[model samples]
Target: MASNRPAPESPYTTAVFSEDGAERSVGEWNPTAETVRPVRGRHRHRVMKQRGGFARSSTVLGVGVIAAVGAGGIATAQNKPAIAISLPDVDSLPGVGAFMSEDAADGAEADRERTAEYETMGLAAQEAQPTAAEALRSRILEQAEDQQAGAAEAARAAAERDAAEKAAAAAEKAEKEAEAKAEAEREAERKAKEKAKAEAKERAEQKAKEKAAAEAEAKRAAQLAGSYALPTSSYTITATYGQSGSMWSSGQHTGLDFAAPAGTPVKAVGGGTVKSAGWSGSYGYRIVLQLSDGTEVSYAHLSSMTVGAGQQVSTGETIGRVGSTGNSSGDHLHLEVMTPGGSAMDPMAWLRSKNLNP
Candidate 1:
């Protein structure tokens, strides 16, 4: 009868091998077929023909045990992992598919863990993006403000320089103008001083000329007294020419008088040609003399004569004698000086005219 459920695993049909032992079969079977021998340090697979219960059972058990061991090893390795591992060369083994599968599973687990870590890092980076953007914007704004401040400072400095230059220019111009004004004032003062000095000199010279002319006119208008010589022996005047007298030709004495006894030589007062040297009627033995400037002198009552009419005579030369000649007067000589215009003046006063005051 055919069973409905699968057949139970048979121990006699299962394969069995050893790590360091000889190859052996666990169960008995027909020895009529050829058996393939495993190499040294190797394992073999078994094929199922009619009943596959042994093969299936062994495969299941191998997978379950490997899974459990790998899980336990991963848990233990989290704290203390193996330092060195000696894995069997799977390429040398004929039936190592199960071991290869186990290694692939470990690789898959590591890849899953790495992917989870990267995902966590990405989430953290995404959360910090706004702060980084704000920092960059702040840096840009600060740089812009700094540039604006620098430009403002430069502008202010330029304006200050221009103002300073303008002030300096004004100061220079004012200084020049002040100097020019000072120079002009000095020139004006110098010219004014020169003009004042010139005017003073001119006034001084004009005053000197006027004073000299006035003094000359004063000398010209002065009165004169008659000139005479000492022409007698012990003869002295009893009265002057202007004295009031009893022997009068006028109310005053008309002529000078010399009271002498006899003849005395009379001299000419100035050099001239004699106009007359002879006697006259009232003036006895008188001589009339004319000078170079047309003035005449009279000698009255002469004792003798040494010069003739028209005879040239020198000054201080004797011309006649002094005696009582005319009008019963004593011996005398009358000397006179006259202007060309017939004006007579007193000889005594005229002799004092030249500041000699003789």
Candidate 2:
């Protein structure tokens, strides 16, 4: 809307309009009249900064200059709507209006107003955006979460590795223990086997010793049963058994006599022990042999006794030498046989029974 007011008289004049109201005056501005739209507030520089009004003004001015130049040469004599431009206290310039049509001029004014409105809306939209601090804080929180996640992953991996190592160590220890136990068992078994074998061998040795002793005893008994020997090597019968003579202690001769050289070896009749060997009253130095079966034989008138009391003699083993020393007429051995009861027996019969010709 346009207004009219009566002013005091001065040399300066302001914008004026004609009655049809399409033509108006803008002073010493671009021919498009767009410069006037920037007069929005007292804080004009601040408003221009917020809205980017200067940049829009420059773009609009450039387009206006180009359009005016193109239309300048084509200005026909046609009567277009009038647009007036002026300086203060000066008359309006109508010549500049010849280059642009009324429609173009009006469209330029509308575009300028729409552009300002659009710039205002753009500023409001910019104010609605998030501030820089809020964006920075969100980025920082996101980065912190990423770092925490990475640390958790690393810790989990470390824990898993530790558990694996422990498990492996436990398994190895168990295996070693098992091996040691098995080795101990094997050693015990080997020792047991060795002990048993040693015991068996010892038992076998003892049995062998007992068997050998029994066999030796049997052989000794056999030899004693089959073997007997004459008392001297060579001799002649001097006194017959049962002969009546004062030489006998009994009423008859008590023994048989063999006359032989002095110092003749007297042999045992069988395997026996010498029961006595020494001097007697009438028998001189005598040796009495007791057989294994408890028979006793005596060799009297010995020059020297070869065996001692309790000495063992086999068959044909020398017991004494033949000589006459007491109650003897010459060098002779008086051989006598007796029973276990100390009574004399027939020496001839006894010698004959033992397979002796003497």
Candidate 3:
């Protein structure tokens, strides 16, 4: 195509648009057809490798889009909004773009196509690594779940075992307590039995002692019966011992009197030796008999004495004759039993001890 611009001038100038949206000339020069051409894929262009002095360069910029009007120029002033501009593509430069032949352009386009394919392959490799990481994380989560389940089961088993051991210990303690209680009861029963047996034996021994004492008393009574006898028969008792009356000298009678005829025979009461046959002051005629057991019987108011002094006489032998003698109110035998110490006894109680009821 032929150029519309006329010619070049000495001082170079360019055209620009103003703030009022008008076009005007700022400088004058025509870039001939050799120096300019249509833009070829301007946004996608890259810088080529340097050859000779002709180096072509391109760059990507993140700026606002330049909107255009009728003329293709940019302009701005201070404090004014910036206007748009459009660039004209050139085919040749004095030292650049001249070495870029059609063959080299084709080769550059092939290299760009191969580089895009290689970037796509690298993207696939990066995506595969994250997928494997996610799978490994899943495997770790599954193992953690299994371990938790196992731990829960083990804890439950241990709890059951501990409870069982505690139950067994409690049972053993209870068993021992029961046995101890039973043993204590048995011991109490044994002591009670022993105490009862001892009490029974004591009662038996007491009864035996009582029986022996009774038997000994009976034997003594039998011996007294065999050894002693009553003095006289066919006589009336008068003037008993401890009788009070002024019959003669002593106010109280000291002997038992057997009333009989004046010549009645007085017999010896028991086996005895004659202690005396004499005439006493109050008794008149008297005889004192001494028994083998040291007891003395005196017969007073005897009319006559048949057994002399120191005569050994048997039971019922004639010892004297009854008579009304000195201090006697009548013919009666006055008999007295005396202890060896000369203390007078109740002759009635004394005869009973000898098994003589009278």
Which of 1 and 3 is the better model by lDDT?
3
Q: What lDDT does each candidate get?
A: 0.57, 0.72, 0.67
* Number of the top-ranking candidate, with TM-score as the measure: 2
TM per candidate comes to 0.33, 0.51, 0.36
Task: Provide the global lDDT of candidate 3 against the true structure.
Answer: 0.67
Candidate 3 collision pairs:
13-27, 13-28, 14-27
Q: Candidate 3, which segments miss by more than 4 Å at Cα?
A: 1-226
- What lDDT tens digits, residue by residue, belong to model 1 across residues 132-192? 5557668988999999999999999999999999999999999999999999999999999
Candidate 2 residue lDDT tens string, 6-77: 322344555644555555975533322354343434433453353344334544554554345334423432
Determine the C-alpha RMSD for candidate 1 after optimal superposition of all C-alphas.
Answer: 21.3
TM-score quality measure for candidate 3: 0.36
RMSD of 2: 16.2
